[model samples]
Target chain A: MAKIPIQVTVNGQTHQAEVEPRTLLVHFLREDLGLTGTKIGCDTSQCGACVVMMNGSTVKSCTCLAVQADGAEVTTIEGVADQGNLHPIQEAFWDNHGLQCGYCTAGMIMTSVELLQRNPNPTAEQVRAGLEGNLCRCTGYQNIVKSVLAAAERMGG
Target chain B: MFAPEFEYHRANTVAEAIDLLSSNPGAKVMAGGHSLIPLLKLRLARPGVVVDIGGVAEMKGITIADGNIRIGALTTHWEIESSSQVAEANSLLAEAAGGIGDTQVRNRGTIGGNLSHADPASDWGTVLTALNATLEIRGPGGATRTASPTDFIVGPLTTTLGETEILTAVNVPVLAANQRAEYAKMAHPASGYAVVGAAVVVNVDGHTCTGASLAVGGAVPAPVRLTSVENALTGKELTFENIEAATAQADNDLGGEILGDFFASAEYRRAMAAVETKHALFHATEVAHH
Candidate 1:
């Protein structure tokens, strides 16, 4: 099968790619576009390892087809920072030791950014529930919850 | 993991979608792709043509008509979880939607797809069954048939849906006054698949049960309403003792083999079904009384 031409916007930049019809969004981001920040831990949807904000909502890019995202805006972990400055969510994760292996950090931070945006002020339980999709094998999720709360506080949520 | 080669057609309308499906025997509908895509990747489902009905906007929303709630087939779990109408009219549905796989899965997974797929462990099946929800289906013949939740689902990963049939909407009655319901489940840690789940509905009349509906999920090839439990609870006082007695049939009702893995044994899931059934019934009774 010939590759389909898809137009997508990622990290405020528009790009065109010829990809197979079955190409997953994660591969388009990592392999085609050369944005390798999004890691693939488990090809299965169980791990939140490939999380990305698509049109303002966090989704596992691995599960999303690239063609399905045609004309849709995407934000990877690389796009979270503004003007070379770390986003508040990133700073909170770093300061609170939210990650251990750091493999799940990008997805955790990205998912948390969207979570805090929807819920400015969230309880610890809310944070846990919000990030339930993203899994961190290293951290017992205690610090991740703390990091999300800390980010909310920093954002004056 | 690349899916097998297949022609893709994005159908913008139900009529067009039906036409596409009618043209091929192995055409499959894709909405959100949360369920179908994984099957494609696993090679468990190999459709000759992938009909993308996700572009159809008409098959979406939550509407109230004639005191019945009509939810479009494409309405995502996130939409249902966040919709105030769902929360107000049918809080049990909202609660079940909220308990699905997770935020990402909820954002993309549609209730209609979930119900049509008829996954036995899905949250929607147990809750919808307890509510006696109706499925509005459209097929190649352009005829619409409504099936109750119990009738819609035939078995695991199977439904009454034909090759050219597409689920259009789900209709649920606005719960009667003084009727309360709750869903309780023991979630599988890794995949978030429910090990044993139960949805309990109670109608209270001055401390006496006027109506009761109990359904169990994640314990068999399909979710089933527990008539024995319903009989035990009906006309009984809303009390913890009554709830426990009613829930005792959970194990007996779950006579079929349960899907088990390293996470839980079949026996464990059966025991948890009774436990969760009791828990759901207790909460439903509490909500009805107060």
Candidate 2:
């Protein structure tokens, strides 16, 4: 198969590469770009472990083809923080004990970032609904919801 | 979980897309890839070529003209869910769009792909059928045609669309001042696909029902318009008892075997279809009264 050229901006960095047509966004991020924060949990679109923001909207990176994202802006888990400091959402997750095994944290945090951006002062039910796509096997989701609320408050919402 | 290697063609225009499809008989038109990509990764569908229409500028937006809401084929589910215009015109469509899959799925899944795929449990199929939405299809040789949801979807995962045809847009009738619609569903917990989804649209004058459009999905192979329920509700008082009685005919128009799975049995789905129909009707009536 011929390689398709693509230009994608990730975390304020623009990278140009030629990849196979079958290369998924998640694979291109992890393999070519060495950004392993975006985990491939289910490989299927069902698990939101591969969630990333594409053009300001959360999308499952495992299902999005690399060619489809050509010339598009993508923000992965690695882009959430400022330098060595953690984003407020990440700090809240740590302060609120939002993870147990920490497998689904990256996707969870990324999704919450968009959720709060859309709804500054989301209710408990709204947070739950917003994070419906990302699932955590550990923590029972109680602390995750608390983390999102704490982030909302810390952000002065 | 990697997809098989295939040729990729990004069409700059609708004509280029149709031409690619016509030339590559084994090619598939990919918009959002929420449906097709999964199949590709799972090895369920193996096409020789993939024509990516995601960048086609003409097929991406929502507009209202001539009393109809026209949605471009590439419009994502999240766009529809958040569009204030769509909500103002038909809140039921917005509600249905919001309830599809999950937040991530909504961001990438397209309404045209969902309808063109014709998944039996797709929420849009039931809602679009109830709303009497029409689809515009473009094929090879610059041919164009329109089809209703019922006429376009023939069976489960099957559509009347030719292999070389591309769905360009979907046009839905705007809700009248006296009209109200709602979609109610019993969603499968894991997949979020509808186990039994019902959509009801009614035009009421004072307390009398002047017209009704009722449709159900996930109960049969394809989304079905419940004419029996429509007939039962038309010209009747829009009361709780009358609505319940009318919804009882939900299964009367169904003619084929109901779908059954571990999540829901065929018998349970049949019962829930009627229950959901009643629920949708009650909500639509409440909205109408308000």
Candidate 3:
């Protein structure tokens, strides 16, 4: 099989590569594009560490083929912060100590941004439900939940 | 951790997808990459070619007319869950969609992929069985056919779909004003797949049970209709005690080999089959559960 040429726009920048059909999107982001902010905790798709925004929805990048994103607009954790300023969700995570080891922070923040975008005034249970895809092994999820709530309040929604 | 090498083809229409399937003998159709991608990574499924129908413009979205709801094959689970048309027409399907794998999985999983994979625990199988839904299938040369849930699902991870057939859409009669339906399940803690999912549709004129249709999944090799329970409730009044009594006979109606594993033993799943049926019937009838 020949390498398939795909053009994907990541973090508002277009990058073209001739990737194997089997190469996963996360591998392309972390290895090909050198955007390692999106960690690959479980390459089997169990862990949401490779979560990224595809088009307008969050998808597990580890399960997605790089070729499948031929013309998709992708947003990685590297794109969440504006210039040097952190997004409100990132700021809340920083203020609330949302990370114990910080392994799951990128995916958590991305999923939270999507959740808050859809439901700006979500309750604690809703926040928990929305973040069900991303798993944190260190924290018991109390502070992570708190971080999302704080972010929700600070964003005034 | 990645799928083995395979040729890839993108289909723009159902006819093109059928052409790809017929040409590539061992190709698999990928819709949302939720079910197929994991299987590929796990090496549970290996194909020489993969025909991605995700970009097919004709195979996305939901439409309701002629007293029926038609859901395109590529319609994502999230789309079905959040669709007001589905909720108003068939709340059972909508609720089951909302609870299907977590948020991201639901956002990526599609109805066609879910049904074609035919996982025994697939909630769509059980719900569509009770609803008597029709599965539209298209083959090469514009050949077409329809199969009900019972006929479509052959066994675990198997369906009646031919190698050259593409599941185009799912058609289900809208729930009438006199009918109520609900799907109740005991989802696996980690994956959220059903352990004992039951879907029930009951018709009541005032208080008398005019008719009932029920099916159980997760605990069986395929979705099994609870004919005994349906017969038990058909002529009786729709009361808490009546629903309980009817669903208690669920075991007598469960057909095929019972499914079990370490997480849920055969005996446990068998018992929960009755319990979930009762719960679904209770919820459908608005009967209070103690």
Candidate 4:
């Protein structure tokens, strides 16, 4: 297979590399860029464990090819923190105990960030509907929904 | 699971995409890659070349002309779900788009890719079939053709689109002031794909049904218009008894073998299709009354 040159910005940093056209964005983030915050639960695109922000929209990175994201800005879970300070959403998740096993937390939090960005004042049902893509086997999504609501209120929604 | 090794070409225009498709044998077009990428990763599809049309600027966005809402082929599901034009013009289309997969899938999946893939459980196909949407296809040498939703999908995961043809846009007739449409579906709990989906569009003149279009998906190899139900509903009062009586004929027109899986059986799906059709018609008639 021929390698294609791709330039992408992840976590506010630029990285230029040549990758196979078959390389998925999740693999590129975890392997090539050493950003393991994005997890790949189901490569079949059924699970949202590989969700990431691409060009301001949340997408399952496992389904997105690296070459398809060429020159696009991608934000992973690692980008949620600011200079060693936890983002408000992260803080809300921690305070609300939004994680049980912590495997789906990164994707859940990343999805929540986008959700709150889109709808600043989301209801509990709205939060549940918004986070439908990211599944959590633990906590029964009670605290997850609470965390998003708290985050929204903390962000002055 | 990694996709098989294949050459990739990013096309900037529909013509370039067509050229790539014409030049590369067994090449597959990649829009959002939500459907094809999964197939590629699963090794269900192995192509020599993968034409990436994600950057084709000309095949994106939503517009209205000639009393029709023209949605570009590359228009993402989320865009359609959120579009005020779609919501106002034909809400069944928007509702169906909103119910497809989940947020991540909808964010990355495009209508053209969905239709071109022609998955049997697809939500758009049923809604479009009911709405009588038209697909604009472009092939090599700048040739173009239009296909109705029913004619575009021939079988499960099959479409009338040729190898070198690109679905440029989908044109759906805007709903008339006296008309209303609704979509109801029984989605699989895990994948969010429809188990049995129904879409109904009704034109009511002072509570009397003047016209009706009904379609069902996920129960058969391809979405089918319930012509019997449509005919029965026409010229009848939009009442619960009439709607139920008409929707009971839903299974009469279903051709081919009914789809069955671990999630649902053929008998169960057929029964549920009738139920969903009634629900869809009920909601549509309610909207029409208001």
Q: Which stretches of candidate 1 lie over 4 Å from their true place?
A: B255-262, B287-290
List DockQ for all candidates.
Answer: 0.68, 0.92, 0.83, 0.89
* Model 2, span A25-113: residue lDDT tens: 99999999999999999888876899999999898999999998899999999999999799999999999999898889999999999
Q: Point out the worst 10-residue segment of candidate 3 chain B by lDDT.
A: B281-290
TM-score (all chains, Cα) for each model? 0.95, 0.98, 0.98, 0.98
| Residues B1-290, model 1: lDDT tens digits | 87888777788999899999999888888899899888888998888788888778989999987879999999999999999988889899888898899889988889888987777788888898899898999977688898988888878898888888899999988887788889989987777877888898888898888888888888777888888888888888878778777778766677666767677777788888888888887777763231
Q: Is the docking of candidate 3 incorrect, acceptable, medium or high quality?
A: high
Top DockQ model: 2
* Candidate scoring better on DockQ of 2 and 4: 2
Residues A1-157 of candidate 3 have per-residue lDDT tens digits of 9888999999999998999888999999999999999999977666788999999899999989998999999999999999989999999999988999999999999899899998999999999999989999895599999999999999999
| lDDT of each residue in B1-290, candidate 4, tens digit only | 79999999999999999999999978999999999999999899999899999989899999987789999999999999999888988777788888888888889899999999999999999999998888999999999999998899988899999999999999999999998788888999988888999988898899999998889998988899999999999999989899889989888888868999888999999999999999888787773221
RMSD each, Å: 2.1, 1.6, 1.0, 1.6
After superposing candidate 4 on the true structure, give the runs of residues whose Cα lies further than 4 Å from its correct spot: B287-290
Chain A only TM-scores, each candidate in turn: 0.97, 0.98, 0.97, 0.97
Stretches of model 3 off by over 4 angstroms after superposition: none
DockQ of 2: 0.92
Arranged by DockQ with the best first, the candidates are 2, 4, 3, 1
C-alpha lDDT of residue B122 in model 2 = 94
| Tens digit of per-residue lDDT, candidate 2, span B1-290 | 79998899999999999999989997988999998999899898899999999889899999998889999999999999999999998898899999999999998899999988888999998999999999999988889999989899888889999989999999999899999889999999988999999998899999899999889998888889999999998999998889888888888877678999888999999999999998888888883221
